[model samples]
Target chain A: MTTLMNRQYYLASRPAGAPDSSNVPARDVPVPEPADGEVVLKNLYISLDPAIRGWMGDDPNYIEPIALGDAVRSSVIGRVVKSDSPDFAEGDVAMTVGAWEAYTRVPGVMLNKLDEAAGIPLSTYLGVLGPTGLTAYFGLLDVGRPKAGDTVLVSAAAGAVGSVVGQIAKMQGCRVVGMAGTDDKCRWLEEDLGFDAVINYKQCGDYEAAIRVACPKGVDVYFDNVGGEIFDAALLCLNKFARVAVCGWISTYNVPDAPGPTNLWQLVAESVTVQGFTVIDYMDRFPEGIAQLAEWVVAGKLQFREEIVDGLDNILPTFLRLFDGSNQGKLVIRIPEE
Target chain B: MTTLMNRQYYLASRPAGAPDSSNVPARDVPVPEPADGEVVLKNLYISLDPAIRGWMGDDPNYIEPIALGDAVRSSVIGRVVKSDSPDFAEGDVAMTVGAWEAYTRVPGVMLNKLDEAAGIPLSTYLGVLGPTGLTAYFGLLDVGRPKAGDTVLVSAAAGAVGSVVGQIAKMQGCRVVGMAGTDDKCRWLEEDLGFDAVINYKQCGDYEAAIRVACPKGVDVYFDNVGGEIFDAALLCLNKFARVAVCGWISTYNVPDAPGPTNLWQLVAESVTVQGFTVIDYMDRFPEGIAQLAEWVVAGKLQFREEIVDGLDNILPTFLRLFDGSNQGKLVIRIPEE
Candidate 1:
C-alpha cells in the first residue's frame, strides 16, 4: 500500500478570547497504526459545537482543557479502515471522540458501532439524536423540570440544543416561548415548531419587556444558552420557584470580561434554582435519552436542521458561525469518502 | 385608661444606600383599637434581620415590600394588651409579623402563641429557634445537600444562619470551613463551634487562596450569606457538582450597585447548583426545623449568640451593624415592657 497521510488541525496555543487560525493551525502527519484493541477510522463527519470554544481555554470545566500541541477535541462519526480487536472490523462504521482530522485511531472499546443499514444519516448521530439532543432532553426534563401549564423560556431557541429543548418542553404540556437572534428563526420556532410564542431577541429592545409580553404568566423554567444581558432580564421575569437550566453561555464565551448578571439577587427573591450542566453529566443515561429522541423523530414530533460544510479546511470558520448566530442549526463538516 | 400611645419607627422615605435616621424616624401616635379579628400587642422583642433591609427597597421579595410611610416590617414577640378575637386574651404572649413599634395590631389567626412558661427566653423565638436558625436548617440540609465526607464552606460563618449551617453540616458528617470578619469570631467558629478550619476574611489577603488552604478537599457545599468579592472567589474553588445555598447576600444588600459575582462561570465549570431560599420557603416544615434546632440547643449540640439591643429606638443602628459584621450572631431589639 502507498503511504497514508493525515491532516489535522492542532491547538498551537491557548486562546485569549475567540480563537484565531494561529491558535489552531493545520498540521500534516502520517496516521498511526492501530494498537491492540484499537481501531483506525477515516472520519466522515466532524461536529462543530460551541462547547469546543470552551475546551480551547485552559479553564476548569467538566472535562480537562485541550492541551497545547494536541488536536482540538470533538465528536466525530467515521468508518473503520483497520481494526485489531474482535469488537470492530474493517469497513464497520462507528463514532467516538475525535478531532478535525482525516483519520482517527481510537481504542475499539471507545467506539459505538453504528448500523449503516439502519437508513438514518450518520450526521443525525452528531446532531439531534446525539450530544445536543441529549443535552436538551436531560437539561430540560431533569433540571428545568417544567410542569404542565408552566411557561418555559428558551434562549438560542433556534439552535441545536435549544430547538430540541423547546420541542420536548411542548410535549411535556408546557407553554413554550423561544428567543432567537433573527425574525426568521423566531418564525421557524412559532410557525413550525409549535412554540407558544417567540421573541426575536435581536429586535427585542428591552429583554424584560419582551419576556413579560411573551410570557405573561412569568417564566417558570428558563433554558439558558446565551448568558449576559438576556440572562439578566430573564432573572427579573422569573416566577416564584422558577428553575434556570444553564447548558451553555455562548454569548459570553468569547468575551472574557462579560459582566455578571446584575439581577442574580432575584434568585433569592423568587426562590430560584440555577443549575449548570454539560451533556456528559448524564453520561450513564445517554442511551435512554438517544432512544427517546429517536422515537420522537420517528413520530414526526421532533424536527431539526443540520448545516453540513463539505471539507475539514472550513472547520474553524464554520465553527465561528455558532457565535455569530449565522448557522441555522447543528453544524458539521462532512469529509466525503475517498 | 389614659389614651395609650405607640412609639413607632416609621419609614419616612426610601434610602439611597444604608438607611439613616431620615429614612426611618420616630413617631408617637395613639395605639389603634383592635378590629373584630385583630389583637393589639405590646411589642417586647423586635427581630432585626438583614432581610428587613431588602424589604426596605421596592425590590420584589418573598413578601411585599414594607409600604412607604409604614412602620418597618419585622417579627415581634409581644403580649396581648387588647383583644377583639376569642383566640387571644389580654396579657397572652405571641409572635407575629410586627413592625418597629411599641405596639402591633395583627390578626389573631396570624399570631403564633408562645409558651413563655417553658423557661426559654422569649427572644430565642426570634433567633436560634426562629427564622435565622430555620434558614440555616433547611437551606443547608435541603438546598446544600451535603454528603458525608463533603467539605462545606460558609461565608459570614459567625452570623446567625451561617453558624447554625456549619454546626448542622458537621452533624451530617461533613468537614466544615467558615469565613468570618474578625479573629475573635474565627476563634469562636473554630474552638467553640468545632469548625474544621476558619478563615478571617478581613485579614486574609486573598479570598480564593485562603479558601483553598482551608478547604483542602475542595468545597462540595457552600452556604453563602455575604455576597461580593468573597462569593466570587469561593465560586472558583467549588468541587464538581457542588451546591451553593444562598440565603442572603448581606454584603450586596446595602450597595445598590454592588457588582455581581464575576466568577459565576464556575457554576458551569463544576456543574454547580446555586439555590436561593428564605426560611419562608420551608414554611410547611418550620415546626420540624424549630424542633430539631431546639433539641440541638437543649442538648448543647447547637450553639448561637444573640446581641439584644435595649430599646426599639436603637433598632436601625443595630440592624446596620449586621452589614458591618459588628453585631455577633442573631440581633434583636428589646422594648422593655411596662
Candidate 2:
C-alpha cells in the first residue's frame, strides 16, 4: 500500500478585506505519510464558516492564522483510507481538521471516529454533530447560562450555530427570539425551528426598535454570532443581569473598519456580562456536548438544516454566501460523491 | 423639634469636567424629629466618594440623582440622637444612606446597627466592613472567581474599595498587583496592604508598560474602579479566562464623555469576561459578606485608612477630593462632632 496521497494547499496573497478565490488558490501536493499513530482520510465534507475569515488574516488571535502557503485549515468529515495504528480501520469515518483536497493524513489524537451507521448524515458531522454543535452547546449553557423562562435573543438565527442555540434555549424552556437576514429565514426559524419570535434585521431599519418589538420583556440572554450593529442593538435591550455570549463577529469580519456601538454605557447601567469565547475552549466537554445535541436532534426537540453545495470547486463561493448573509443554514461543501 | 434639617446640596449647575465646591451649596434648617419605625440621628461621618459625582447629575442611573433643591444623597455613619424604632436606641451607632447633613430621620429598613463596642473606629462602617468591603468581597470572589496562584490586578489601589480587594485577593493565594494615582498610595498598597506589586499610574506615564511590569504572568482578575486608561492597560495584559469586575469607572465619571478604548479587539483574543455590578445586587448576601469582612479586619488580615474632614460644610470639598484623586484612602466628613 502506498503511503502518499494528494492534498490541497493555499498559495501566496492574503486579502485586505473579504476573501475571494483570488486569495485562496488550492494546489495539489503530495499527501503526508502517516506516522506511528496517524490515519489517512479521504475528504468527504468541509465546514465552511464565518470564523474562517479570521484565519485568513495575519494578526494574532485565539486560533492561529492559516499560513499563506498551506491548505486552508478547516474541520473536515472524512473516511479513513488507511491507518498506521490499530485504533482505526480503512472504512472508519472520522472527523478531523484537514485539507480542502481529496486525501490527507492527520494525527490519531486529533481525529474522532464518526458512527455513520447511527442515522446522522455525513454533513451533520461537520455541523450539528460536530464543532458548530459543541460551540452552541457549551457557549449557551456555560457562558449565556440561560434560565427557564429567560428571554433568549440570537443573532444570525438561521445559521448553523445560531439555529442550534435557539433550539437548545427553547428546550431549556426559554422564550427564544431570532434575528435573521431574510424573511424566509425568519419564517423557517419561527414555523420549523420552534422559535417564539423572529426579526428580519435587514428589513428593520432600526435594529434596536426591532429587538424592542420582538423582546417586549427585555432579553435575558443574547447569543451573538453577528456583531457590529446587531450587537449594539442587543446591548440596549438587555435585562438586568443579562448574559451576552460573543461567539463570532461575522459582520465585523469582512468590514475594513468595524464600527461598534457608541452607546456601551448600556452595559454599565444594566449590570450585564459580555464574554468572548472560542469553541476550542470547551474541547474537553465535546463528547458530552455532541451526545446531548445528537439526542436533541434525534428527538426532534432540536432541528438543524444544512445548505450543502455539491462540488469542491464551488467551496469558495459557497463560503462567501455566509458573509453576504445569503446562506440559509449550515453551509457545508459536499465533496463530489466518490 | 421642627420638621426640618440642615443639609448640603451639591447642585450640578453644569456637569463638571472636574467637580469643585463652586458646583455645591450649603443650607440650614431645624432638625427633624423621628417618626414611628424611624430614628433621628446626628451624622457622625459622611462618606465622600467618587460615585457621589454621578448622583449630583441629572442623568438616569442606578440610584436617583440629587435634584437641585434636594439634599445631597451619600452614605453616612450616624449615632441615634433620638429614636422611635424598637431596633435602635438613642446612643446606638448605625450606618445609613442619607448623608451630607448634620441630622436626618432615617427609615428602620435602610439602617444597620453598628457595634460601638467592637473597638473599630465608627467611620470604618462607611468604608471597610461596610459597602466598600462587601463590594470587594462579592465582586472578586463571586464574579471574578480568582483561583489559587492567579494574578489579580486592582485599579485605585489606596481607595476604600481597591485596598480591601487587593487584601482579599492575597487571602485567596493570588499574586495581587495594585495601580494607584500617586507614588505614596502605591507604596502604601505594597508595604501595608500585602499587594505583590504596585504601580503609580502618574509616575509610569505608560500604563500598559507599567501593568506589564507589575503583572509579569498576565492578569487573571481585574477589579476595575478607575476605568479609562487603567482599564485599557489591564485589558491588554489579561490572560485567557480573565474576569473584570466593573465596580466603578472613577476616571471616566467626571468627564463629560467617557473615552472608550481602541483595543477592545483584545477581548476576542483573550476570551476575557467583563461584568458590571453594584453592591445592591448582592444585598441578599450582605450579612455574609459583612461578617466575613469584619472577621478579616478583626484578625488583622485586612487593614484600612480613613482621611477625615471636619464639619457638614466640608462634605462637598471632601467629595471633590475623590475626583482629584487627593484622598489617600476612604474620604469621610466628620460632620462637626458635637
Candidate 3:
C-alpha cells in the first residue's frame, strides 16, 4: 500500500505579538491511515481567520491553544479520500475542524456532509454559508436583537462575518452603518453591500463624531468585530437600551497588550448590553442559520467576497494578512489539487 | 399664610473632576405652597449616593444633569406636611425624587407612599428597601442570572448596593467574594454579610491574583459597582459564560477621564455578558423588589448599615465622603427633624 505525504504547518513557538514565519513553520509528513470510525480527507480549502492568532498563544480562550510541534488548528472543506465509517464515503465533500494540512485524518463524527449539487462553490461553505454566516446570523439576531428602524453599527464591515451582519441587520429594517479600514473597503460596503453608511476609520479624525453623523439616531445595536478604538467610538454612540454583540476582537487579537475601550461606562449610562459569543456556542442551531443564510443567498440579498490564497506553503503569510487589514473579504487558502 | 424658608443645595458650577463646595452650594429660599395636585413634604432623610457625582457633571447620564443654579436632584424620604391632592393628607411618609432641600413641593404622582407603621425605619426606605435594594435585586437576578454553586464577585461590596448584592447572591445559594477598600469593610462583609471571601483591594498587592485565590473556581457573576483597576482585575478572572451586571461605576464617577478595563477582551475569550442598568428601568417591578427585600429584612435574612450625617449644612462634605470611601454603608443625611 502506498502512503500519501501531507504538507502541513506546525506551531513552532508561541508568538510574542503578531505571528510570523518563525512561529508557524511548514513541513511534509506521511498521512496516517484512518482507523475504525475515522476518515482521511483531502483538504481543498482552508479557512484563514484572525482567530488563528489566538490559537498560537498559550492564553486561555474559546478554543484550546495549538501545542508546540503540533499541526496548527484550522477549519477546512475537504473531500473524503478514504473512509472506514458508515457516516462517510469516498468522494463525499465534508466540512470539519482540522489542522493546517493538505490531508487530515479526522473522526467521522466531526465531519458535516456538504451538498456539492447546491450550485454554491465549496469554498463558500468555509465562509458565508458556513461558520462565518452562522456567527453573523446568531450573533446579530440573538445577541444584538436589532429592531426595525434601529441604527445598527458594525466594525470591520468589509470582513466575512461583519458583511453578513450588516446585510442581515438591513433585512431586519435597521439602518446599517459599517466601519472599514480603507476607502476601497468602505466604498465596497456602502455601494456594493447595501450598507446605509460606511466610515473609513483610516480617514476619520474623530471616530465618535463620524459615527454620530452616520448613525443620526444613535447606535441601537453595535456588531463589534474589531475591538479597541472602534469599540470605544461605538460605545459613545450607543442609544438607550443598546445591545453590543461582541463576535470577535480581531484588531486586538495580535496585540496581546491592547487597551480596552475607555467608554465602557456608557454601557451603564445607556442601559446597554455587551455580550461576547463564538459560533460553536450555537452549534446545535447551525441548520437554522444555514437555511436562513442560504435562502438569502438564493434570493440575491446576501453577497460575499473571497480573497483566495493558493498553495499550503503560503498559509503562514496568508494568515498574517488578517491583522494588516489587507484581506478584502473572507480570506481563504486554496490547497493545491492532489 | 406665612411662607417657610427652605434650605437647599443647588448646582453652582459643573465640577471638572470631583465635586466640592464650589460646584454644589447651599442656598436658602422660600418653601412654596402646594398646588391642586401637589404635596408639600418636609425632607427628613436625603440619600447621598455616588450617582450624585455624575449629576454634578454637565455630561449626560441615566438622569438629567442638574442644571447650573438649579437644585441638585436626589431621592429623599420626607413627611407630607401639607397635601392638596386627594391621595394623601398631612403626616404621610413618602419617597420621591426631589431636590436637596429641607422642604419640597412635588406632584403627588411622583411620590410613592411608605407605610410608616410597617415597623421598618423610613431611612431604610432610602437604603435596603429603596432603589439601592431594587438595584441589587433586579441587577443580579434579572441581569446576572447567577445559578446555585456559581461564584459571584462584587466590587464595592461594603457599599449599600454591593452589600445587598453579596447577601442576595448568598441567599440564592452561590459562593460570594467581595472586594472592598478597607480591611474593616472586608471584615464586615465576611463576618456580617456571609461573604465566602473578602479581599481588601487597597491592601492586596496583585488584585487579579487575590481574586483568583478568593474565587478558585472562577467568577460566574461579577456585580461591578466600581470600575477602573478593580474592574479590569475582575474581567481577568471571569469564567466561561459569566454574567456581569454593571449597576454602577462609582470608582470612575468622580474621574472624568478614567481609563477603561484593559482586559475587557476576556469577554470574547470567555463568552461573558456585561449589562448596565439603572433601578428606574425596573420601576414597574419596584413593588416586587420591595416586597422581597422587606421580607428578607423582617426575617433577619438581610442586614444593612447606615452612616447618617446630621444637618443639611453638612450635605456637601457628606456627599464628598462617598468618593473618598469614608462613608460606610448607605450614607444618608438626617435632615434636622422639626
Candidate 4:
C-alpha cells in the first residue's frame, strides 16, 4: 500500500502584522502511524476562529502560544484512520485539539468520540454545540451576569461566540444590542437573530454616539470580542455597576503594539468589573454546556449560521476572512472524505 | 454667635494640571442659617483623600463633580454648632460629607454621630476607622478575595488605604508585597506592617523587575492605588486568575490625558479580574466594615499613619501632597475648635 501523505501548514515564524505564507508555510510529509495511546485521524472539519490567530502570537499567553515549527493549533473533527488504543477504532469519528493539516495524530485521552448516526450534523459540534457555544454560554452568564431588563451590548456580534451570546442574553430577558462591521451582518443580527438593535460600526461615525442611540438604557453587559477603539467606546457607554466580559481582543491580535483602552478609568466611574476568560476555563463543565446547547438547537430555540469553505488548500484564505469580517457566522474548513 | 463668616475654598475653574490659586479661590461668605432639617458643624478634621482630586475635574463622574463655585468636596469631622433637627444637638461631634471650609451645614440624616467620649481621637475616624479603613477592608477582602497563601501586591503601599490593605492581607494569611515611593515608606511597610517584601518603586529600575524580585510567586492580588506605567508593569507580573482591586489611580488623576495601562491584554492571558470601586459602593455595609476594622485597630493588629496639617489655609497644598506621594498615610486638614 502507498504511504499516506499529510499536507500541513506549520508556523514558520511569528508574524508582526497580518500573517503571510512566509510566517505560515505549507509542506507535504509522510503521515506517522499512531504510537502508544495515540490515534491518527484524517481531518474532515477544521474550525477557523479568531482564537487561532491569538495562538499564533507569543505576546499574550491567554493560552500557550503555538510553538514554532508546529502545525498551527486548532479544533478539528476527523475520521480515525489508525489507533493504538482501545478507546478509538479505525473509521470512528472524533474531535480533538488538532492542527491545520490533512491528518492529525492525537492521544486517545484527548479525543472526544462523535456519533455520526445521531442525525445531528457533525459541523454543529465545531460551532454551536462545541467550544464556540460553550464560550458564549459561560462568558455571558458567568461573567456578564445580566439581569432582566439589563442592556447587553455585544461587539463582533456577527461572529460565532458573540451571536450565541446575544441570543442567550435575549433568553435571559435582556435588551440585546449588537455591533458588527458590515450592514449585512447588522441586518442579520437585527432581522434574523432577534437583536433589539444593531450598529453597523463601519457606517457609525462615532462609536460612543452609536452605542448611546442603540442602548438608551446603557450597557449593563458588554461581551467584547474585538478590542480596540470600539472597546474604548464601549467603556464609556457602560452603566453603573456594569460588567465587561472580555472573551478575546480579535482586532488587536494581528496588529503589533495595539494601544490599550484609554477609558479604563470608567471602571471606577461606574464600579465596573472587566474580566477576561476563555472557553477552556470551563473544561470540567464541557458536558453540561454541550447538552444545554444541543437541547436549544434541537428545540429550535437557537439559530446559527455556519459558513463552510471546502478543500484544505483554501484553509489559509478562509481563515483570513475572520479578520476582515467577510465570512458569516461560524467559519469552518471542510475536507470531504475520499 | 457673631454672624459666622465661612471661609471656604470653592472651585473657581477646572484646572488643566494642578489647581493653582486661580482654580481654587478662597472666599469668605456668610454662613447659611440652618434649614428645617439642617445641622451646622464647626469643622474640626477635614479628610484629604486622593479621591478629592477626581472631584476637582469635570471628567469621569465617580461622584458628582464639585460644581463650579462650590467648595471642594471632602470628608470632615466637626462639632455641631447649630441644629434644626432633633437627631443632632449643639456641641455634638459628627462626620459627614463636608467641604474645605470652617463650617458645614448639612442635613441631619447625612451625619454619622461620633462618640468623642470613647477616648479615640476624632481624627482617627477620618483615617483608620472611617472611609479609608473601610476602603481597604472591602477592596482587599471583597474584591481581591485572597485565599491564604496568595501573594498580594499593593501600590502606594504606605498611603492610608494601601497601608491598611497590606495589614489586612497579612491577617488573611497571605504573602504581602508593597510598592511605595520612598525608602521610609518601604521600611514602614516591611518593619512595622509585616509586609513580607517591599519595593521602593522610585528607586527600582523597572517596576516589573522589582515586583518579580519582591514577589517570586507572582501577584495573585494587586491592590492598585496608583495607575500609569507602574500599573502597566504590574499587569505583566500578575499570576493566572489574579484579581486587581483598583481603589483609585492617584498617579493619573493630575496628569492630563495620561496613557492607559499598555499591557491590559494580560487580563485575557491570565483570566484576571480587574474591578474598580469606591468605599461608597459598600454604603449599605459600612457599619459592618467599620466594626470589623475597629476590632482590628483595638486589638493592635492594624496600623495606619495620618499626617495632619494645621489650618484650613493649607488644604490645597496638603491635598496636592497626595499626587506627589509626599505625605505619608492619611492626609487631613485640622482646624482647631474655636
| Native contacts matched by each model | 0.75, 0.40, 0.81, 0.76
Model 2: per-residue lDDT, tens digit, A55-145? Answer: 8887657888888788777888888888886889899989888866777688888888888897778898888888888889998999999
Locate the minimum summed-lDDT window of 10 residues in model 4 chain B: B253-262
Write the residue-wise lDDT of candidate 1 on A1-338 in tens digits. Answer: 44459899999998878898999999999987888899988999999999999999988888889999999899999999988879999899999999889999999999999999999999999999999999999999999999999999999999999999999999999999999999889889999999999999988899999999999999999999998999999999999999999998999999998888889999899999999998889999998999999999999999998899999999989989999999999999999986
Q: Candidate 1 regions off by >4 Å?
A: none
- Give the top-scoring candidate (DockQ): 1
Candidate 2 colliding pairs:
B4-B30
Better of 1 and 4 by lDDT: 1
Instruction: Tell me each candidate's i-RMS in Å.
Output: 0.8, 2.2, 1.0, 1.2
Candidate 3 falls in which docking quality class?
A: medium
Off by over 4 Å in 2: A1-14, A89-91, A256-268, B1-5, B10-16, B19-23, B29-32, B57-60, B86-89, B262-268
Reference-based TM-score, model 2:
0.93
Which candidate number has the best lDDT?
1
- How many Å off is the CA of A114 in candidate 3? 2.5
Lowest-lDDT window of 10 residues in candidate 2 chain A?
A259-268
Q: What is model 4's DockQ versus the real complex?
A: 0.78
TM-score of each: 0.99, 0.93, 0.96, 0.99
Assess candidate 4 and give its TM-score to the true structure: 0.99
Alpha-carbon deviation at A25 in model 2, angstroms:
2.9
DockQ of each two-chain model: 0.83, 0.44, 0.79, 0.78
The global Cα lDDT (0 to 1) of model 4 is 0.92
Full-model lDDT for every candidate: 0.93, 0.83, 0.90, 0.92
Candidate 4 local lDDT, A228-266, one digit each (tens): 999999999998999999998888878887777789889
